[model samples]
Target: MKKALAVAVAVALTATACGSEEKDDAPQFAERGTFTYAIPADPGELDPANAVLGATNTVLAFAYDTLVHSDADGKIVSGLAEKWQAQADKVTFTLRKGVTCADKSPVTPQTVADSMNYLSDPKNKATLLGVLIPAGMSATADEAAGTVTLATKDPNPFLLESMTAVYVVCGEGLKDRSVLKTKTSGSGPYPLFESVANDHYVFKAREDYAWGADGAKYEPSMPAVVDLKVVKDESTAANMITTGGLNGAQFTGADRKRVEAVPGIRKGSAPDGIGEFFFHQGEGRAAADPAVRKALVQSLDLNELRTIASGGNGEAATHLTSLAPDPCRGDSVTGNLPQSDPAAAATALDGAGWQAGTDGARAKDGKPLKLRIAYQTSAGPGVQAGMEYVAQKWKALGVETELVGSADAKYSDSLFKNGDWDMAWVPLGLSLPTQLVGYLSGPGPDAQGSNFAHIANTTYDDLAAAAAKQVGAAGCGQWTNAEAALVKNVDVVPVVRPTQLVASKGAMVEVIGGVVRPTSIRMLKN
Candidate 1:
């Protein structure tokens, strides 16, 4: 039974959005069923608007609804919004009628407007704000028109595409942000039915679900329940696949090849996304000097790192926006990264006034040129090897590097607290240049801006602002130029786009853009 409810008051929102992939023609099954998969670790948190990890996105996508989505080819498509139209400074979205939350609460158009407001409020501190919505944007609901209009202070050409990543939450969860930490209140085809701490997670399909991405349609074929488990050991996950105990797993390295050896196993992959080291310049840090930043970047052999990290399955990255669904495509990074030249790097450092000691350590005012570099151990062996390789190469250049913590422990800490590391090889993979705007063009450390690398460039800012005025494909060229400007200046380094190879065991499971769309997975023929 669906409740008939309406918000008498029109919702005025601050502004937030994201992009998504659509699955339209989902397969139907003869009988209700269940599906299970395994993972190496638990995705940290489930909140869509708050969490920063992509792991959270990989799992929660099964239970959330974004306003708009992108097709595999990167074209914008309808999601929760039936359709949208853009004008000079605003984009109007017409919500789908009768969509309901997991708690059976009716998700009115007001719910979406409310969601936008919830994420927009500064006190709420939604991590995705600027990445999805332009700074100083707002939203208004036109009840009579059955639409919610979002307007930015300036223009945002990628507004529609950005919405693909901003999942909508109903009023209940929006009202109390804490509730979302332990529970889910979503409007997608499945709800997070149960989660066994560090062990497994389960979701049951919503029988009356209506708004699924293009690959997922509401019908008889939807899996009755989705079961997910965490199998830490790769061998254990592969064994489960062999026995058909689990339908799929996010495989990597040799495990992917092993899964291919299994007759029934299905392999799926998306561009592994891109990776790069962040040379942080927190107050007085060694890398606080751009010459050190440039010298360090130029010192390492990025080509070799790409080879090790991608396991020879990928090529050097040309764009930071490598997500398959990214609407903009261009080569802004080629020939732009600092070339690996030890002599030139040493010369640059020498010119920067770092006197080389007899021990081969560069020092200024008696402090050796020693710095800590942080990397996440959670990244596969290939990435771990790449980080080590980088450290060794930097050491050989006489720039002392202390390979410190796992980013899992220090990512948030480094960003929010008294930063502990001077250099970090943290690479973020995003589909839109808009997403990169915050990290690439914001104010430096004192303001605590999202520019993790402490980059502040008015030129790039102006270029981005100009790109925002034109919508969609028309503005991609300008956005690329803006990003290229950043790359050219070394404000941010764009690295290689790697492949995310996932090996599946069942023939029934359909994979798109390298992921198993839960709603599209049907039972294998007996």
Candidate 2:
């Protein structure tokens, strides 16, 4: 299936490209060249085990190859494995032959199985764990049979779908894992060439690289050497595209004119991605108060948040899994989640015994109603302004807000380290809400994975578990209801699913699933 898809893409691109035009004027097929793009933030962890940031994904995704690959729409297809069959408590896969790791190591059936087992082991403490693979699942290899069997403890409805996230690295890289932090060592399309710390990372295409998924390749002026430069500022990134010094950038929120102002620059966007707040509802916290959570939800305007967050290019988010190839396939969000009304919010707070003072600050028993809001460190000026706008609106409703930021904060530190924060602007995008099991349940703030909200509701937990038992489209309704359950408890404030917009040189590039995948990009005219 993957090869067929690749063939189709190659055919389409081949048919459209001009063969008669001058070689210099047409797309220059360089034997070896470089492609440069600006990265908004530094990927804190390059290794798959500890990587959590989207910034990291952009880099690591190209540097490593997963066992199973998903399409632009999130449909799972074969990568290193050619085929598979599911059994009662395990799934067996036929490994693809001649696959080689970036280190020039052979990727045998046992090698592939061992890599999966490496991540699955409880002792390894891989952060991805159940989020990427089934909880307590292990893979065993049979070399003679040329197959690997993934055995799970119990039924995993989204197991196959979630396996799409697993990126397999070779045994050599796995032994000395510390070196992987600074370099790339996997069977990925682009291998790591050079690293300039937080400034830039340069990658080179392999001469023997023929394992591209679905006919994906960086041929025809795609540039042999790829330079990923770190440019934190969106406005600055836009200028780089215009000047043609930088090839393109992954930018968010209102920078179309700045980019299109340059000739031959093209822009593409995907409206399916989501970015919303996960309010910390720990005990004694003001957000813990159901009334306070409701008021907080009601006071802030979703539409306004959308406008400011995406510079009017985004729409208000409804469900947790808003992205395509999403496990839960419906707009489960309701209109009653929270409507921004200062009057209503004020009334709700006042009735809950918090009275507005002459200074327009709410206080109860000499305790002022203060809320501290935290935003992502990588957020641009517009997003920061949007957060400030929301803060101002909350302040007008007699609530005082304190804004703070952590430098590329980790998932655990953002929740556990800073226990004082009431509401955080932590936006998590998941292809499956089931990917949130550990986040919503489990032990401590650190143990609960990305459950930054610190919610421990038995009702929501049970509902999610029950929904996880159902498979495929049959489970969509249950999953939708499970999301509704979270909304009902006000565990999270679901906001707009912002459209992820990227601007690039119209030298013929395509943006799939809101990303400029290194392999999928090709050139029309240089």
Candidate 3:
């Protein structure tokens, strides 16, 4: 699905904050003002069902509501549904009374059920299918009882947690999906007021809105209007935050120090996966060969690679998925990944029939071993430098490397559509292991599956299948072992864990699921 295809800015700041006292002195709140923040790129689509960009999710939070919500710590909280219970195969949610859609229509159980059912059907072709919500899942609502129950074809351990990503569309938007491309119809904290394609989007807060993560209610401290500005450059965004041109923005580049030096600015940091490599194991790709994959990994010092990728502000990654509210906290990558040994790498490449020619380039059967390293252009200079270092290492092994850079929005096209990349540095920022099943082990891109890497590790598939059957943490062991299978076999490489930092000025907010929570945004005094 789109979740795994795209790399979201996985920045989680606080679990549950509402302009409370962060210091001994409680900060003053403005009567009512506009809150402006910068998104790394333009949120391409407004429809939550088909889009998975962190920028879109940030904007969607102001207009859409999920069945349930989770705190930064992954604790389940009340959202549209006041109370709910979840089993391995089924989850039932009781709708909160007096909730209304943006159109002023009462939100009924049938509406919620319809939204869930629409997202779960594979025929609908919603990108969230099989990733956020399981495929073939069905939802039924009892109008009289004010309850909606969801049942999946197969048992999903994190079904309840997964619902947090299922943004419920109103009946009108579901009927005519075209209008949703540019408008908002769901019941959230704010509705779309205006949008300018690549510039900014404006939203006005709903005065009557009361439902939020962790039972948060709208207050005067909350912004009357929200502005999401598209600022691609991290240095410009940092400067904006320092000069009070913006309320908040996340930075992963060298410019973060500039913002941190400014006084009275609020900041939050959390781990986000970086420098991860996805080797495209397609038919003719150089990395398709296990020997080549092992040799390539063995040729580099991953610890140094991590430092290069994160600007010396990261640690060796211990797991594949690093998004906050992570359910499974296990070390699947410590001893599983290939060790750094240049001699071993040379031997493996030589044994694979890749011989060095006069030009120091390896050729086998008259075809040279070439690698195309694809990375996001907006991932900062650190990622670019790290990828160049990788290119150099592979070049030392007599393999030709080409650095292919793509924008954040078009990176997926380069990986899936162009099908030209040998390896990519996109990190899958998923909170749960079940959410990674579609991307890591399943039908490949040709069959419309999210496994763009074309990984076919039977051990991973079998272990993942077992993990999917267990309830919640009961199957965490299987999930951990499954992730190890991917690393041990060199299907994917988890390189580094970088701390994602977000700076704020004139406002205080919490970032959940990689975007600022609209309700948690509190306008501060001058």
Candidate 4:
């Protein structure tokens, strides 16, 4: 099926660019060549600690080098640190010598220490940092010995994996945290040379970068230059690929067909992690009813929704940890999750005393079954399609769904934080299980403190806290239990898992290895 699709696309492209043979054979790499890419939206922030989305993290992953990094396979690998040792609750890292930032400041143990402290500090905790580090963890640096010690309140099995996000920014980079909101300054292989929000961004390769992984095969003869141009419309991006103007860009199902039709353009999809809508369980209306929440989950038509939302490109998700590797062996909950059944949904609604009215809308007593769902307009094409599909499904279940779309990006804060919306389509990304602690724990955003979901569960909190302390198999089991609890409780519904589509001009772009990291894009020559 995949091969046939590929062939059909090639045939379509042959007709679109009939006289573009010379451009198809153009040299992919030149001494000072620049490759232009089109991003879907303008990155909200450049600070590694602040970035939450994959696109923003892609830029930060190149601009900043973390203490530890994940390889192509998402395995933990040393980045700025050559080696490290863990003793009980303390992990000591041996900093690599002779490393310097883009500003030419030497990277020392003090720099590592300062950066770690800043990230782990409660005052400076951003969404990324909060997801990376455990609660009550601190770091101490020894410049003379070239080592930085991390002290944890409890044993953390996934500490190294967590460090994959602990980007080591220099002291100069820390002069003003807000400045990093728009600008980037780091010691990674790439440096941000120019940035015109939602228009174009340029990244220049670092000539002095010598601290890459031991066996990593990244050697750019030409000073690698990455030019990212924001193209909101996927059709325009696909058009650029055929015109030989863009090296690579993301595409939708419609754009994918158009691009594949172009003779020399290649179409590919990488696992984009999971994408789902989370209900603010602590907010008004639905906050007081668990049966309604369960009914909502049961009412979803997974198969139909996945088809429409993915445009035949994605799969239905069963758990919060979708597409991620199973951390625990011999665990029954690994792939065991409830499927959608309308009969079950009706039963759940009946149990909650919400009977269908003459208008086909469910109601309890005198109140109608109405819900307001808020979604960000800039989340991407797939999300928009997914939201529409979900809203339609909910309507079929005799529920009134008020669909609200926003572009100012303040919808998430206003809806989730202020409890202004009953449900929202929010995509939360985390590489490891430990990274999900904040979102699952009670006292959520709706609560007084850090809870974003506004739903509280003492049982779920206890299981998550205990699981976080365990390492390896034991830890995985506990985490799995916590995940099961969340699913069974219907704290949040798991919808469709999305795959990222990177459309590029095949003649001018050759993505070295099929290494798809959610946080970075390292392209190579043909």
lDDT of 4 by residue, 1-526 (tens): 1111122111110011001112334345434456677766566678776654445655665677777655444445677888888654777899888888888888888887777778777787555444556667788988888999888887777776667656778746766677687777787777788898878878887756777554232355434677777777778887887888887765544777777677756555554445566667763576457778777867876667666666676666644542222234223233434468888888788788888988888888888888888766655566677788778878988888888877534664554346677777665433456656555664654344445666566766788788766664457767767777776666766555565566655323322112222123333355
> Order of all candidates by lDDT, from best down to worst?
3, 1, 2, 4
Candidate 2 yields a Cα-based lDDT of: 0.66
lDDT of 4: 0.62
Worst 10 residues of 3 by lDDT: 12-21
How do all models score by TM-score?
A: 0.84, 0.84, 0.90, 0.81
- Residue-wise C-alpha lDDT for candidate 1, range 46-108, written one tens digit per residue: 777764444455567778888876666776667788888987678899878777788888777
Once model 3 is optimally superposed onto the true structure by TM-score, how far is the C-alpha of residue 216 displaced, in angstroms? Answer: 1.0
TM-score preference between candidates 1 and 4, better one: 1
- Cα miss at 251, model 1 (Å)? 2.4
Clashes, model 2: 4
Rank candidates, TM-score, best first: 3, 2, 1, 4
lDDT of 3 by residue, 50-156 (tens): 75666778788888898888677767789999988778899899989988898888889998988888887778788777667777889999989899999988898
| TM-score quality measure for candidate 4 | 0.81
lDDT of each model, Cα atoms only? Answer: 0.68, 0.66, 0.81, 0.62
